[model samples]
Target: MDASSAGEGFTVALASGETVTTRQILLATGMVDELPETVGVRERWGTGVHHCPYCHGWELRDGHIGILAPGGEPFAELRVTLLRGWSSNLTLLTDGSASLDRPARQRLEALGARIDERRLRAYEDGPDGGYRVCFEDGEELPVAGLFVAPSQHQRSGLAETLGCGLDTAEPNPAPFVVIDSTSGETTVSGVYAAGDLTGPAQSVILAAAGGARAAYFMNHALAAADAQAALTAAGLPAGSDGD
Candidate 1:
């Protein structure tokens, strides 16, 4: 599918030779998480490997949990701290990526979390329905679950094609779509956005709330536009007159 500007509205072209036109557009396109290319990771993503602690922490509580601290993760230290709450037996797998400083190493140790800098080789099934992490150094660690800090990106490129700006801030694995906090309006007027594509709060409840808020403002904007069109068609001033 392809979309572009068409006069005062926008036009969307579908692959099946269909087109849609609208005066306003709300982009609820979400994000995509890119995991490491380690063996056995891709196949067991949602079932065994996860990215969010709040979403999956309770299920794996009090068990041996491993945090796969991949390189370039902006909040590596913070992630370890959060996951430690869910499982006292926590291990931070550096995978030959994290080089912890003295203080950082000491902090993790204080939290009773072990730091493993071994290069990860692959993952195999453990005896108890868990995962066995194999290292290149011939060492293995078994855990009930593994939390990965994945690099994320927009699921669709249509937003950029339509000239929506992105927020380039630290700690965000990927740049998110920039929108007016009060109105959910994108940098491009008449175009709006909501949900995970807008910010770091990637929860179902928050995404739904965002969509509702954007829809409220979108309805008002469309109503105003229609009123102006009616006035112009009747050969009257655009400004409101006594009704």
Candidate 2:
């Protein structure tokens, strides 16, 4: 089903025909992983195909792992090279996209990783319960795990529908909401954004900071409203601070 957006507020019409609504919307939606257009890649997600080595590498320690270079030098090569600490059996699959510089290639070679210059054709579940990656050059490699560099985009369509802007960058270039540094307030009023939706290299600690900032602003707004009500009840100008 297609996600629709309208004025006042957006509604996600579920497949079961249900609608949810709210007055003040906060889009803390995270990111979407855009996979490479390759065969068998989609079928093995999480099980064999992965994006963040930091998230999945530990489980694959001391196993034969393959790193597929989709794009970007910083994230594609550098990140996989860093994963060498987890496993001595790492293979770099170039897939005929980008190549490494001298320093980068040396580092990869030093880690005892081999490079596959052949273009990736497809991936299939290995008979031994791992993965079999086939290249266009008729070369096949068996790996316990396969890592890919997926392009990440903000997962919230609601943010974009409400006129929230985006910031695109290298490594994993994608769109994300723009917000104030201190308040987590988006360009759209009454709408606050946080987490990876705001595109700020958000880890757990950073996400907590964003939530606190938004809470602070919302609390201040509510407090000001309460103060105004008290002033009105006491027959004083709301603008006056009892001076």
Give candidate 2's error at residue 12 in angstroms.
Answer: 11
RMSD of each: 2.8, 4.9
Q: What is the lDDT of residue 72 in candidate 1?
A: 22
Compute each candidate's TM-score over C-alphas: 0.89, 0.73
Error of 1 at 137 (Å): 3.0
Clash totals, every prediction: 0, 0
Candidate 2 local Cα displacement, residue 206, angstroms: 7.3
Q: What do the candidate models score in CA lDDT, each in turn?
A: 0.85, 0.74
Worst 10 residues of 2 by lDDT: 1-10
Q: What is the C-alpha lDDT profile of model 2 across 165-197, one tens digit per residue?
A: 776654335677888887788887657788877
lDDT, candidate 2, equals 0.74
* Model 1: worst 10 consecutive residues (lDDT sum): 70-79
